[model samples]
Target: MTETITGLHDVADRFDAFLIDQFGVLRDGAGPYPQAPAELKKLRALGKKIIILSNSGKRSVENSVRLAKLGFDEACWDWFLTSGETAWRMMAAETDGGARKRCLLISRDGDTSPLDGLDYNRTEDADTADIVLIAASEGDRYDLGHYQTLLQPAAERGLRCLCTNPDKVMLTADGKAFGAGRIADLYEELGGAVTWIGKPFPDIYDQAKIFLGAIPPRRICAIGDSVEHDIAGARMAGIASILVETGIHAEASPTERAALFALHEAAPDFILPDFRL
Candidate 1:
């Protein structure tokens, strides 16, 4: 029963701030959407506060750089928040309390920025690691089976996995690819415990609320493409939501989209064909 709309301007006056998703809503990994920058500028001109709520495994600074590189105006958004930044802050704040944990990181292209200033020791062997950090997926290079084999040792040892990105699929230059969340799911299937640290989770929303100052939850809206993450997260956070059909669910048929909504047990207040002005 979601109302269909053309773009953000349709509901511009209904909200004071927006928690916008980055990956599928703003860009497709390779470039930004054609109307995205203009849409952002329009929202900014309307005196709306904008925050990029991304489930990326990279830090906020990295995301901001990427956005700028993609031709987005830096003045469009007031703040940028990513699950990786949230996880990094949490990890950095942890006091080893005399027992430093050994971490085995699984990130795209071996990026270790998540652990750059952390106290956890990095390990190359899963058998020697105390916890598994599923920050990003190398889906473009390896298959899910590759991860299953790589993580079996850690799973056998009952190591906990901290998944910074909870996206099940990532948009690639070619098409959809496996995401870090899928890898975390595999670890759970292999009997390893996983701690999700991204969208659809309360921690990230709580942090977004802090950044939003005293904006009432009822006056804020979240826009994203994933039913499981964006829409569901908004429901859990007690805010309005808008579903964009330009990201993970871009190609979903009517029946498939219905199934997804039912499966997630959540629906957006409004739906848009894409993120536009």
Candidate 2:
């Protein structure tokens, strides 16, 4: 029974800390939401702890700079974390015992900063690679179909795919763009094993607990646009969630939204029209 709500103001008093998503809640790709920064400031003023949790494949610093450029200063939030940062640290520690030392990297616009300072060898040929790591998509021009040729061969080789970003799509001012998760899904369909390291996986939420202190699950709320990612992640992590309607599912009607929640089995405690606090 998810209740549709006007905004976070209706429930802000019920939680002491907030785990917020960046893509659709805070800003689209173009810039910051008109009221997002100020609303965050209000929450902070009310003594609420806020952490920006993103499924972005970019590192923490890169995302910080991007947010700053979008008119959100570091003062607006207490801390920020990204799936890329978590995955980069995991790879740096060589946590995956099954993955080989060499990896075939799939990325966007030549951004390979996640692999920087890591000992893993990079290869262009998937045949010679030990594993496949997808950090980003090629953007709007490409879709899941465009990567079939690349993933099919790797799948046949039985390569393990590590997807840093679990978001299937990202909504920005320009439009929706396919993400690494879409390609990872295709690989799985082709029988390739995939390790999703971001939202809905629980590892990222555990990492976030470090910043959230010892706040109980009931006291924390996750606000995001994706049902499969954000809402499902929160449910699995033992925290409440508020599904924002204006982001990924902006075009979905009430019936479609209900159907999505049912399909995912991840109904949020509340449904917000937008991220207006």
- Give candidate 2 misplaced runs (Cα > 4 Å): 95-100, 143-145
Q: Taking the tens digit of each residue's C-alpha lDDT, what string does model 1 give over 28-102?
A: 977899988887887889998899999988899898988998999888888899999999998887756777778
**By summed lDDT, which 10 consecutive residues of candidate 2 come out lowest?**
94-103
TM-score of each: 0.96, 0.93
Segments in model 1 whose C-alpha atoms lie over 4 Å from true places: 97-100
Give the C-alpha miss distance for residue 154 in model 2, angstroms.
2.1
Best by TM-score: 1
| Candidate 1 C-alpha error for residue 5, in Å | 0.8
TM-score of 1: 0.96
Query: What's the lDDT of the predicted structure labeled candidate 2?
Result: 0.85
